[model samples]
Target: MSAEPTAETLSRPPTTSGEAVAVHGVTRRFGDVVALDDVSLDVGPGEIVGLLGPNGAGKSTLLSLVSGQRRPDTGTVRLFGGDPRDARSRTRLGVTPQETGLPPTLRVGEVADFVGGHFPDPVPTPELLEQFGLTDLARKQTGALSGGQKRRLAIALSLVGRPRVVLLDEPTTGLDVSARQALWDAIRQYHAGGGTVLLTSHYLEEVQALARRVVVIDRGAVRADDSLDAVLRRVALRRVVLTAPADLSTWAGVVRSRPVDGAPPERQELFTPDADVLVRDLVVSDVEFRDLEIRGASLEEAFAEMVAPESTPESTPESSPSIEGAVR
Candidate 1:
């Protein structure tokens, strides 16, 4: 490991206003196909920002550009106030790309040792392996590890540096629920130790669980950026599942309702945020509720709605989406 500035030197906290990572008016094109278009966003130090989008939405392109693996055709990108290609930037950042870059024939420990050499004050190789639950697999070739093991090993390589900023591109791809939970725990610990994390994931649940804020991109542009709660509230979808005692005839503003096709034929309800008022109206209509369950808008629904084709018009007016809801 390379020598590092001591805690006293690094103790000056980053400014809340100045971005830890910034992308301004960024644009990238490959033979006229725009991968990114005039996009701008920032990540604050010690924040976990979820970068989200559908397939071909340019999430990977944005990450690659920031990591210096690929450069933008137009606009500026800065990491801790410097170009990503700068030596300081490279040393301060850790990246786990979607594709595993490890050599198949290399032993797990060897790979960690190699990557660890690039950082200042690298974690001990043995400790790194243990931290990622790869200690038993240390002597095994990378090729022999199972998919989940390989992914975990890849994460270990990135963490060897104890980087200030971490770019995790789909960090939980192959893991089962338990393994994913373990990874989330580790990431939380990283943040607690003062690391900033930027993640791109197809799993909405994962983002909701892990990210404090989220940025949704679609069609090469930013669609939404705000706190996770804000995105869900903006979508404003409501689900009301209930069993009714009466026939429950038509009620105004009730979007859709159907009898669940079970032996009991309980009712399943779907509606918007207007359901609160509609429920009041239901009393006048003499509807009886035997059982009722209400669920607020979910991140999955918000993400789908934001990236849906029809929401394209909403993307232009705001650089990023804003939310006004409290974190639950």
Candidate 2:
């Protein structure tokens, strides 16, 4: 590839007409054990999709298939309407793995420049370093950076090619609150610039905040794929906390409320999806309480219920090891 392609040769014009990614009846297995089972989904341009599941729930496998690192045994995966494994097709995608795989001795700027050399039109090394908060450490060796700095550098490296679709697997793994926030802002900017993002994260708050849609997979299959609002409504289990003025038995419509062990009996509440009607009737009937709180079910809670071990195999690999190699 040329060191740099001009605006006309390098930039892939924004397309309002492509399925950024598409997987149909995808399945993969290891001998007798299935890793992914007939999973199918579509990601459109400029959309951020969250993939949520428990350990060994095929989250990483699915991402690998989409990124062309692994092929599905039973189905087809298309990136920009071409085979995922094709080199030309892959240039359109960027990836950030959970662990940093950067060379320890390379300076931050040098590392970015080295990776950028692979692209026809790389984002300027200095701009990317600054964009990811690594400007101050531009000449610092990767080995000398802190955990969060290393992570930020890894993220900057992933974007060197200015890819159209970005796959982020636990993109904010080791960053502190401020650093994590910075990454989130960068991601928002990426999406705003018309790039597609597919994120696999165990952090429910991360998914809820960043993803416009979510695809929940369990037992190697897609259990649910829908918008955040729709998914939350379907995964209807709310957390209810309240203070009781009298005995639990006296409270009407109280599904269940027992004092926590070693806790005051007067302070009791329970979790239920029907919080609106349930609490409304109680208050109307003169139920007295010092405090009350009703919170919606989070993606974590929904994920726990969806991918509970009962539906998966007894033993399986917990996590995929991060791929490591020099960026050639």
My TM-score estimates for the predictions, one after another, are 0.74, 0.75
**Ten-residue segment with the worst summed lDDT in candidate 2?**
319-328
Displacement of residue 215 (Cα, Å) in model 1 is 1.1
lDDT (tens digit, per residue) of candidate 1 on 1-328: 0112243126547754467899999999989789999999898777788987766788889998888877889999988888997777888788874446668898989988988899888999999988888999999998888878877876777678888888998888768998888888887777767678899886677777778788888778998899988865555566666777654424566543444444265465544556687677776767777577778645444444455445333332212232111100
lDDT by residue (tens digit), candidate 2, 1-328: 1112133222445355468898999999978979999999998766789987666678899999998999789999999888889888888888874455778888888888888887889999988887887889999998898888877777777788999889988788657899888788788777766778899876666777788798887668898899877765655566567777666543444433335334576776454557787678777877787678788755444454455455643332221212101100
lDDT of 2: 0.74
The lDDT for every candidate, in the order shown, is 0.74, 0.74
**Candidate 1 ranges with C-alpha deviation above 4 Å:** 1-12, 15-17, 235-304, 307-328
Question: Would you give me the overall lDDT of model 1?
Answer: 0.74
Alpha-carbon deviation at 185 in model 1, angstroms? 0.4
